[model samples]
Target: MKLSAFADVCLRTLMLLGSRPDQLITTREIAEQIGVPYNHVAKAVLELRNRQAIEVTRGRYGGSQISARGLQLAVGTLMRDLDVRDDVVDCVSETGVACPLIAQCTLRGALRRAREAFYAELDLLRIEDLTGPASRRLLPFPVLR
Candidate 1:
């Protein structure tokens, strides 16, 4: 399943933070590094903070950092937390539209299994895994403010 841009941004933010655990990283910094908009990054960061995946501090010398809790969280869990459910078939839509094949659709089950398998693979990885040496090299050190 294709992750939403929001979820991708959130992961990118976390990966960046994980690289610099000693410093409080700002949303602007994250947006700049990831090439996402500030407002979008801000919203994602807020959600991460609300979920306790990241910690936010206010006032001077305050920014945001990934919490230890976030480091241990499975990537799939984080993705699920950030995902906005998109029904793969009309039968799954909350609109309650009745489908003729609802009683005999094997496709839905197959799709569901495929989606679950995707997340299951991700579940094997933690946030820390994404911040390892190979991945860290992809994210250069952020420029000074």
Candidate 2:
């Protein structure tokens, strides 16, 4: 299952934060390092903060950091938190209509299982796991303001 753009940003932001662990990264800094728009990263940061995955401070010297609570979380659990959608497929039409084939379609069932499998595999990993040496090397360090 392909994660939503929002979820992607959330994961990338967390991964970047996890790499540093101690540094409080600003939203703009996260966007620049991850190649995402600051606005998008800001929104993702707010959501993550609300979920307690990250902590945000206001005013001068304020920025975001992954919470100790965040460190122990499974990647899949966070992904699920960020990905609020219940189904991999819409099973609905764009014009406010439900798919007529919803009842008889075996494809949806198969897709559901596949999606669950994808997340299940991700469940094997924690946010801290992504911050290990090998993965950290792939992430860019935050630049000074």
What is every candidate's alpha-carbon RMSD to the true fold?
4.2, 3.6
For residues 1-145, write the lDDT of model 1, one tens digit per residue.
7888888888888888887777898888888887778988899899889988899998877889989998888999888767667555567447767787789879888987887788889999999998887887898534322
Model 2 quality (TM-score): 0.88
Model 1 quality (TM-score): 0.86
State in Å the error of residue 75, model 1.
0.2
Which candidate has the highest lDDT of all?
2
Clashing pairs in 2: none
Task: State how far residue 123 of model 1 sits from its true place (Å).
Answer: 0.7
Write candidate 2's Cα lDDT for 13-83 as tens digits: 88999988899989988999988888888999999999898999887888999999888789898787677
Error of 1 at 120 (Å): 0.8
Instruction: Give the runs in model 1 whose Cα sits over 4 Å from its true position.
Output: 91-99, 140-145
Best by TM-score: 2
Q: Runs in model 2 with CA error above 4 Å? A: 141-145
lDDT score of residue 1 within candidate 2: 65
